[model samples]
Target: MASDPNTAPHLFDRALLRARMDRARRAGPVAFLLDRVVEDMADRLQAVTRGFSDVAEIGSPGELLPWPLADRFASITRVDLDESETLPLEPESLDLALSALALQFVNDLPGVLTQIRRALRPDGLLLAAMVGGDTLTELRQSFAAAEAECEGGVSPRVAPFADLRDIGGLLQRAGLALPVTDVDRVVVRYDSAFALMADLRRMGATNILIERRRIPTRRATMLRMAQIYAERFADPDGRIRATFDIIWLSGWAPHDSQPKPLRPGSAKSSLEAAVKRAPK
Candidate 1:
């Protein structure tokens, strides 16, 4: 059955609740991956400064902290849309900003990025990680197969994600400079679809597509979906793999730069010299 467009908000609420349940039930592996990324980020930040006097973490949900640096910083504040429509910080006051696995959920990403840029002091850095478009390929395929077998058609139900290629441009549009983005694909194998759904809940990553059906998903349909997922996507080892593409981004808040004329007595390097100087 096709989703009711009029019930977009209701569907989103239901999907959010389902995601919360999934996170509560299966959080171990997901937390493990999240922690590694946070630690890596924290280590880099620590190298730059002995401590930050003021820092804000957006959409953290009380998790994904690098606790080793907890004592190093003079103050740490957590910000979430659930708490406030606007960021709690004064404009251009934050020393650093960080987020992980959260940007994908925001409805107005550019607006949020603009807010982050506004909250940062000139040259302050923003680092964020979010799930990219290629996540959950196996689960999506299974869902499509189940719809085909039971309903004769599959209406789109998944939330769309930002592409890596376009992320840098978004940063530039938000008035952030020196943007960098990289993709990390993590493949996790599951013995059963039920277990996979459990993990998604624990990670607070249940689907919240605006056009999702409001009616309860029937047990029969769920089972059919699981079976189709296992049969079509399971590996020879009898486990199904879910691929999560995590995109990491870093950028500096905008700053004025003084342009200089070309050097009076310098010449461009030869193509051969440039090729030799590039990293092997």
Candidate 2:
């Protein structure tokens, strides 16, 4: 069950999460998924926005994009949470900021977005993608059932994900302009739930809740979760499926140049008149 929105404490252990990422960076196939999202972000940036002199890519994997497209920026700074501080970005120093699959783990996401807004110059853009929505539903459900049956209780096994509307609200609350949010759901087929869990481990996406049980999960619970997952989510071919919802968000630092919604009731035509005039 989810915690109260008003009273939920920061549950993630940042130190442990960083350690998981360091280990996952060694061998993570999930990087391919992020690579695709990066390509999409790059295309959108190049196609819609002006060329920026200073750009930063937070959480860049081992290699920077090796292509002319990346050279369009006069300078690009790659930052990783493990390598440097994730907060206190120099105020108004960046013209463009990119984050791929990194913001979800933040304990204070709204504050972080506000910081990003502060770090961006007028009209500077923040384009990012994070795991959200229904991500890991099968695993979460399976874990809950297995733990409830075996241990008489359930612990947090998956991180809670925000939906598109909530993220849009956050962007607006951060004083961003032209905020937009969308989602893409991707399902991957696996031989069993164990394979999916292994991939999550390799991706450094495992549970790292501070309130998580200190003792290791029981072996019986693990096996039961696997069985429940297969029984509930397997296809006709007997291969289980895992769901990942990627939420993409874009917002610009508040600037007068950006388009604004027209004032309420400013339209020349009345809504009732327009409806009556329409073909019936």
Q: State, as a TM-score between 0 and 1, how close model 2 is to the true structure.
A: 0.91
Best candidate (score: TM-score):
2
Across 1-280, the per-residue lDDT of candidate 2 in tens digits comes to 1123345357678789878877887774467667677677767776874767788777644344566777778888886654223454788999998888888887767767777788899989998889999999999999999999999999988999989999999998888899999997889999988888888888888988888788899999999999999899999999999999999999999888888898998989999999999999
Clashing pairs in 1: 22-201, 22-202, 23-201, 23-202, 23-203
Question: For candidate 1, lDDT tens digit of each residue in 8-32?
Answer: 2232443464457445655544575
The regions of model 2 sitting more than 4 angstroms off are 1-8, 27-30, 60-64, 81-86
Root mean square deviation (Cα) for candidate 2: 3.7
Please, what's the RMSD in Å of model 1?
6.1
Model 1 stretches astray by more than 4 angstroms: 1-30, 46-51, 83-85, 256-280
- Residue 50, model 1, lDDT: 32
